[model samples]
Target: MAKTQKGDKALHSLFAGATAGAIEAFITYPTEFVKTRSQFGGKKEGPIAIIRETVKTKGFGGLYSGCTALVVGNSVKAGVRFLTYDYFKRKLSDSEGKLSAPRSLLAGLGAGMTEAVIAVTPSETIKTKLIDDAKRPNPQYRGLIHGTVQIVKQEGIAGIYRGLFPVMMRQGANSAVRFTTYATLKQVVQGTARPGQPLPSAITFGIGGIAGLVTVYTTMPLDVVKTRMQSLSARAQYRNSFHCAYRIFTEEGLLKFWAGTTPRLTRLVLSGGIVFTVYENIMKVIGNSGEETS
Candidate 1:
């Protein structure tokens, strides 16, 4: 019975992560479009203006330009993140005989670090092309597949991983901070509630939102550089991740490094909140059912 319950929990966590990633993709697609456009650093249009222009010129479908990649990449990323997190949590809990906040933080860090290698590079490559195209002249890559093929052909498999190091850095740190903060916040919020009672959905969601905001903002500079490097062609300047970061910092001021942060942060908070909330609820349901079966 305990084994069955554990299996169920694992399955539920996977489902929750996948579902959350998919749903968040749709919910935050437009903001992503806006953020991408802003990253190019051309015309300083407000969020509303950028969104309006994108819709008017590109159509509503344009807002979801890189959504396919986002869905696929994020689904895998989230699946790994949650599964590994759960795995770590369960392992730690079993050893310690309790689920501790520090354990959850460690689990999230490990899961996040793992996902950085698995998902960030390819996803950033595709997304950066889509976003960068909005501002620059046509660089020849049509869409996700074309861009991927072009990179592979031109630079070989290594091309696809142009900004991999920074991506790993950004995503790894983001995940660790996000999950750790979320666990800490959830515990803090839950503790405020009456004894034997769970935290309210609002509190949980709020904490998740805050966590996402912190993570995104903290890592926005790395994200900006990652996008720029990935968007470049094989022949383009900025040879590698370090060179890309150096060039961006040298050419553009420090503030420029954080361009498009507003929309990105906004998207992160809202999407992160909703996704985490939904994920937690789904996990709860699965956990409860497992408890029942046991």
Candidate 2:
């Protein structure tokens, strides 16, 4: 019975994480596209204005540019993160279900590193290429599969992982901070209520929003560097994460690192709220520890 229950919990964590990622990506991907474009430093308008202009100029599909890879990537990444987080957090938890903040942070760190290596690097590469091509006067590689093939044929498998280092850094930090903040918030909010106690979805959602906002801000500079590093074609200019950071700081102005922050913040806050709400609710249905902390 204990073994059966453990199996069920693991399955629930994986499924709930995947479902939450898909739903959140579907809802927020438009803003994600805008965020990416804005980060490239071409757009001067706010997200709303940018959205309107994109719609006006390129039609509705414009907002969904490069969505296929983003959606799939997010699903895999979030699923992996939550699955590993559940596993680690469970191992770190006591019989009373009291997992300390540091333990939670460790769990998050493992989860982040897992998702970054397993899913983020390649998918993000494909997604970034599609979006970057959209901005070019003469776009390369007709679509996702074609683009991927061209990259492989020209640059080999290494091309698909152009900014692997920074991506790992960005995503690793993103999940660690996000999960730590979220778990700490849940611990404080639930306060001796025990693992099964019901907390309002609203509160959980709000806490998730705060976590997402902080994570984005915390990693925004790396995100910018990652974007620049991935958006390039042919030989790369920035050698590594630190070099990319240095050039962006010294050359593009320190403020350049924050260029697309507005859209990113908007997208992340809402998406994070939605992800946690959905994830927790799904965990409730699955009767697993994913929602226990909340």
Candidate 3:
């Protein structure tokens, strides 16, 4: 049901997606750090409390410890996501210019799983370590390059993907929720708008933010497990994603699994808002340019 999407159109989607992801990561890095640490669940501090402590102990820079990795990883992750999602969605769509929820869900799942296998794991692993290790007075890894290189050297490339399955689970579910919710929200909003007129940017962003919050609430347990698996700590004792999940569920109960819900929600809500908004705007520009050229 989707329109013809190839050549410049697909490229536009990928570029827009990359731009969106980079912007989202940049805007949310600090909160992301807090979210990562919060997932550890050993600390009694809440989000704000943790932020205050980090600033006091490590300065504002502490909040942005994983920024480089966030930006790079998210750029690749989001770009790949939109690119793949659009392709798969077009492939799976019906002839009536409509997409069923299940198909959309599948498209999202495909997008997430693909990104997890490629970009998300390694980048997020580095980001997690940077945030989790920032508290050390003499942190072993210094910055993004040094940290990444060291992780690879010390633990091999496998270390960078330490929490691959959990990451996949979280991201795959996240994409599924995100695309479906955003698509649904967009359709709902457009239904109210004047025919042939676009939805307002504010409305679009609001939809994205709400969709992000939904995804966060739904996938937070996997996110917590992912963070724990990535972080270099003794407390994170587990053999695999299932093992980690079982441990958290059995030992910490269900509530503990959603430990970093607050910061994660905040980051993702804003990230989603920014990602969709920016992507749409960029696509608009690209489309206009392509038409004029044609």
Task: Assess every candidate by TM-score.
Answer: 0.87, 0.91, 0.93
Q: In candidate 1, what are the lDDT values of residues 1-294, reduced to their tens digit?
A: 999977877778778888887788778878887887776644567788888887887788878776777778888788778877778766777553556666666776788778877876777677776666644545466778876777689779777667777877887777777877877776665566644466556866788799988888788988787777776552377777787778777877788778888899989998778778778777677664211100
Best-matching candidate per TM-score: 3
Per-residue accuracy of model 3 over 172-219 as CA lDDT, tens digit each: 999999999988877766667644467666877898899999999899
Question: Which pairs clash in the backbone of model 2?
Answer: none
CA RMSD for every model? Answer: 3.4, 2.3, 3.4
Off by over 4 Å in 2: 41-49, 192-196, 289-294
**Where in model 3 is the C-alpha error above 4 Å?**
1-5, 234-236, 288-294
Which candidate number maximizes lDDT?
3
Q: Each model's C-alpha lDDT?
A: 0.73, 0.81, 0.83
What tens-digit string does per-residue lDDT give for candidate 2 at 89-202?
888888987777788878888888889888888888888878888767677868778888988998899988888888888887888889999988887777765455667889
How do the candidates rank by TM-score, highest first? Answer: 3, 2, 1
Error of 3 at 34 (Å): 0.8
Pitting candidate 1 against candidate 2, the one with the higher TM-score is: 2
